[model samples]
Target: DLDEVINGALSVLALEARAKGLELRSEIDPKVCTGLCGDPGRLRQVLTNLLNNAVKFTEQGEVVLRILPQEETSSAVSLIDGISGSQAALRFEVKDTGIGLSEDARGRIFEAFNQADQSTTRRYGGTGLGLTISLQLVKMMHGKIGVESEPGKGSLFWFTARFEKHAAGKAALAKQKPLPLGRVLLADGNATDREILRAELTALGMRCTSAASGEEALQFLCGAIADEDPYALAMIDMQMPGMNGVELARTIKNDHLTKGTRV
Candidate 1:
């Protein structure tokens, strides 16, 4: 689950973080268990909520999550503290260095119907359900939730849980070889989209040629037939002024010059 939660959270946060001019950093300790007995979907949801909170609240500064093995397990703690095996479990932590809280606000932070005060909500917008959901999720896994904050500083929220490893010595194999480049003809009246497509397609190791209009694409196809270069794909946007994408594709498909062509 190490790859699962982290990957999904990063993917979900990437777009939002970019829009805010912030960096989402992650450092997962090597010793942390990749195999854990837990609900992946719920874990992802918790991560998403926490990440979204960090991004939404912070105007500047970075948001980071560090995953590591718990130093003290319940069973180990029993031996160290001379307590019985009836001790509670352990879980992981999600901490952020943005928008800390005051002493009074900390007490009722994780309550189901409680959240940061109206001023905090006014400065930042949210339904206040994110932390509630996150707290409950940790509780469901037999864990405890806690937070540390300062009024002008930042906040560190953490939880702990115990999990059993179901699979042993399983490795995620990597696939070999890169995808082959596709030959593409990009046709669009909008120069920006056309250029963007051209750049993206070129980045994908593709051979892409652009046309300003449907007529331009048709002329390009006609020229390609004369000079003999094959096109594997044609992308034509339909809203162009004249000779739209469909017409361009039809012309290419029905042209006598391309009918018996081999390329």
Candidate 2:
């Protein structure tokens, strides 16, 4: 499944990201086809390579993976060779908040055995073959790959690939239940994780509000109760700065007005 492919890629580099105190998140467009006919192994490899590089270069902040369906048109279809009737074009992006690349560095980024500069090689050791291999794999899958970056502003690496939809999976997805509407409060110190969860919850037809700390969450909770629109659920991260998840849960439980809200 396409989900497996994306998750697998992330799993391989999860530890590395956590080691650097970085948040790893994904924002997959709901419209993108989930079950696709393609080489999952190669797809995972390409994704993992990009993510691994992103995590390695980023010391703090977050790394994000975004997937979206590309517009299908006559010209687009013609560009991707071997795209059959069942195939669809999709775009994958790996964005990072790390040391960005210069104009010269971006030009030869995908070249084998090369990096931004000699100092970069000394600072972060690598053969610089990852992007080169990713380029080859993307081409094999009838896709195009490129990068965009500005010095000190991080980078966004993207690629487009074509995959044929799985007939059975599409039918199963069509029969899934409709999403329920509800209000949700997300409390997390990590900006990236909060944003990711908010996007996902919003996509599921829930109204979401985010707070950076337990105190902030409590304020929102009480305000929501006063508005007569209390949140149906509060998703809290276990490890937070000011107050942890357990503390917040207890606070919510003790307050009679907010007690009714689920934690």
Candidate 3:
């Protein structure tokens, strides 16, 4: 999933790379991850930040996004419980040929809103929040993000996010069991997403049901409560045909029967 997310994000950058006359290369290990139980969106964000930074700085040569599996260390294992299920650690690196950084610049680069130098913003036109956000997200997933750069030799920005390996293929996906969180109500206007979420949740042992819109979800929730079997989780879309997710959430919170349900 991580590799897929990275590839999807980078494919869009191919045009930008071509415009800049640099080769954007991806070398992902086939066995890097069989399954990952983290946010694919955030993973894409991290990759986007690193790759965009790489291309922004590099005037020539290639920008490579490489993934390799490794053994998780004691400290990392103790910190992120997610690593316990992982067979091998996943290491992602974005190596580029660019201006590089000084020792002092490298030290504070990961700090919130700080870049290599003040001149960088003037030249690059970013608010320097990308690395800060990436660092926070990587930490949340129980991973580490670092860099190795010299003044003239360019830089290598890397991060490690452990992946939980399971059996490969579609059968594996079908067999995936999510952690049970009781009855779950998936409310999405999109049929495809609703089906996918329902399948993933039901596979995890949750009693799953779907509604096409917020109104439908609310009506079902009310009916479930009247039947004395209330939903414990409501996964609603932000935008829908009827009342939106936020309004539905507010209504749920204010209602007596579903006040305590998690949304």
Residue 4 of model 3 has an lDDT of 79
Q: What's model 1's lDDT at 201?
A: 70
**Per-residue lDDT of candidate 3, residues 41-122 (tens digit):** 8789999999988888888887888776645334344434444643447778899888788899799888776667878767
The deviation in Å at residue 54 for candidate 3 is: 0.7
| Higher-scoring candidate on TM-score, 2 or 3 | 2
Q: lDDT tens string, model 1, 20-39? A: 87757665544354655668
Model number with the top lDDT: 2
- Write down the TM-score of every candidate: 0.56, 0.88, 0.57
Model 2, span 1-263: residue lDDT tens: 98999999999999889989888988777767688989998899999999988998888888999988767433344555666657778889999998888899899999896767788878986537899999999999888888899988989999888888899767766766637999999999988788878877876788999999999999999998888898999999988888999999999999888889889
- Ordering by TM-score: 2, 3, 1
Identify the runs in model 1 with alpha carbons over 4 angstroms from their true place: 72-91, 169-263
Candidate 3 segments whose C-alpha is farther than 4 A from its true place: 72-88, 169-263
TM-score of 2: 0.88
Per TM-score, the best of the predicted structures is 2
